[model samples]
Target: MSRRAEHDVRDLVERARAGEARAVARLISLVEDASPLLREVMAALAPHTGNAQVVGITGSPGVGKSTSTNALVTQLRRAGKRVGVLAVDPSSPFSGGALLGDRVRMQDHALDAGVYIRSMASRGHLGGLAWSTPQALRVLDAAGCDVILVETVGVGQSEVEIAGLADTTMVLLAPGMGDGIQAAKAGILEIGDLYVVNKADRDGADQVRRDLRSMLALATGRDGAWKPPIIKTVAQTGEGVDEVVDKLAEHHAWLASSGELERRRTRRARGEIEAIAVTALREKWGDVHGRSELDTLAAAVAAGDADPYGAADELLAAFTD
Candidate 1:
């Protein structure tokens, strides 16, 4: 990198570490845009990361996820912790940008300097997150957030991906959402570290809680495994939010004492490294739009002149060369 560019990145990192929201936002934008300077940016911020506790909140649509996240942020701030929120929203087809629905709902924190909220477009990536999310998270972690909440694009069944990314995954369910059945089908039964039945004042809330507890009972775990707790809350009214925060702290403590925190973060890092390497390889092979070595190998395979394995070998050989 140029000396000027390196200095610029250093300046941004310093400002972000000092809790400047604009600097933090700029760093995340660089990640989202896949800027050429990303490597330098990541290096600059590396030492300052690994401090924030990441919490991922996910659920089916209309489960009041935004409301719950807003409440959670409110509670966290009341405790004097710096919080960062990454709200993954569906991409707007016209503009290829976030719809800003989560940001809109989270307006309660707009004036708070200690809370930084960003809405990211899913951008057609599957598993309920933007491709840039992990990098954006590093930016937040390096920005000195004490706790970071990732709220996914409520894509239903495939939303369980949050489990792999967070230190604690909180799954939200609501009465009248048929979530009990959907939870089983979506594999959320295994992913959630804590489950919240939002809209707890509704008529069917008790039934929803019972169903969730029974389903959780059926899942077997090793000795000393943390039993996922079910908490009921009316997120709009901030009811029962303190208990949720308390549970989060309890879980974080368990993670540290049990050494699972290191394991989880290591796994997260491995995934991030593998993704970066794979992306680099794809870039080396060149884009699909142009006639590249991959296109040639694919053509040979299609014509039955070269088997897929052999073509793949050739591609790897070329890549290695």
Candidate 2:
């Protein structure tokens, strides 16, 4: 990296550590853009990471995810915790930028110095999260956030991806949103650490909670499994949100006692490392996509002169050798 670029990163890191929001924002922007300086940035931030409690909130659109996130921020802040929110929005087809609807919904904390909120575009990456989320999360962690909430785009089954990244995953549902069946179909039953029925003041709220409990009971849980708690909330009024925070605290204690906290962090780190390595390999492979050796191997496979497995081996050999 150029000397000037290195100095920029150092300045950003220092400012972010001092709780400067704009510097923190710029560091995350570099991560979102996958800048060439990302390696240096991560190295600088590594020592300060692993402190924030990551909470992932996901649900189908209109299930009040943003409202719940906003409420959670309020609750956590009242407890004197610094909070960070990453609201993943679907990318615009033409601009590849976040639609910014999530940001609009979360304006309640817009002026709070203790809270940092960012909207990230999914950029067409599946699994409801932006490919850049974990990296962006590192920025927040290093910026001294006590709690980081990741609100996903809530795009069906792929939304379960959050379970792998967060320390605790909260799945939100509503009374009239077909939430019970939708939860089952989206595989959320397996991923949720806490099941929240938002808009609980509405009709059929009890039915939604009952359905969730029924489904969870029938689901075969592993030995010593952590049974997800069901919480009801009218996020618009912040009703029942304190209970949710209590449940989160209880879950965090349980995770630490059961040694699951360390295990989960280890697994998350493994996935992040593997993803980075795979991306590097893809970049290398992209340069050789139309190489003569690859074309010849493709022709051989097409002609039945060699099987797909054999062609794949040959292609890999070319890349290695």
Candidate 3:
């Protein structure tokens, strides 16, 4: 990392903990670039990370996930909890930048001392989160926020990546999502620690709730020791906000009492360590091998003078050796 970035990251982290909003925003932007200084700052801050309740909210598009997230953050603050929200907006495929629509919905918390919200672009769109993003989450955790909510970029499907990263994974669905329990198949049912039927004021709300309860009863017979609760919410009205927060707190407490909290933190730590190693290797590879070699290989591949797999093998050999 550049010395300037290093100094800036450290100063900004302290400022954020001191409740400097702009400093926190600037620090988040800086870390998104994956600098060496970010790794250092986060490592020093890691001890403070596991204290927060990492809640992930996901669902089909337009089911009010972002609105629900905004409500939950507000409710958390009302309950005296410091909160941070990570809204993963889809990146513009052409520009490679976040669309930020969800962030716009969360702007009410911009100046609140107890709330911090950031929109992350899914690193590989349609695949998973970016490698550097979760490390950024550790930074927020270190800043002393007691609760962190992550909004995954997807419509109805569980965000497997966020589910893996968060302490509690919630799948939010709307009234019309479906009735048959089989509709929850395909990498979706396994991740949710809870199901939220958002927009409960809409038509067919009762049907949605009944369908979800039936589904949960069937799922309870399967494997998980803890049954994921189903909650109804009218996010626009903030009606069920407190209930959601209570549910989150209940799940967090259960995890702690059952010793699952230690296991989850261990998994998070392992993921953080692996990301740091990958980042360090890529940096060394770029510095020692340089971009010129990559450009040459790319040209050869484009000209069909070299096979893509063969070129990749050559790059892999550099690290393996």
Best model number under lDDT: 1
Stronger candidate by lDDT (1 vs 2)? 1
- Report model 1's TM-score to 2 decimal places: 0.92
Model 3 lowest lDDT segment of ten: 121-130
lDDT of 2 at 14: 88
TM-score of each: 0.92, 0.90, 0.83
lDDT scores of the candidates, listed in order: 0.83, 0.82, 0.72
Q: Candidate 3: where are CA atoms >4 Å away?
A: 1-7, 90-93, 101-103, 122-130, 153-158, 178-186, 220-224, 282-314
Q: Give the poorly placed runs of model 1, Cα more than 4 Å off.
A: 90-95, 101-103, 122-131, 156-158, 287-291, 300-307
- For 1-321, candidate 1 gives per-residue lDDT tens digits of 799999999999899999899999898878766788989988888888888899999887898998999999999999898999987654343455555644576889999999999876645332224246778899999998989999876453245556788999999999998756776876777888899999999999999999999988888852257999999999999999999999998999999989999998898887777777777787777644355989888888999989999988887888887
Q: In angstroms, how far off is 80's CA in candidate 2?
A: 1.1
For residue 112, model 1's alpha carbon misses the true position, in angstroms, by: 0.3
Number of the candidate with higher TM-score, 2 or 3: 2
- Tens digits of per-residue lDDT for model 2 on 257-306? 89898998888888778777767765665457555665677788899899
Instruction: Identify the superior model by TM-score, candidate 1 or candidate 2.
Output: 1
- Candidate 3, residues 106-214: lDDT per residue as tens digits? 7778668788887765454222354655765776777778988888755433367677788888888788766555447535566778788888988988787787777
lDDT of 2 at 298: 74
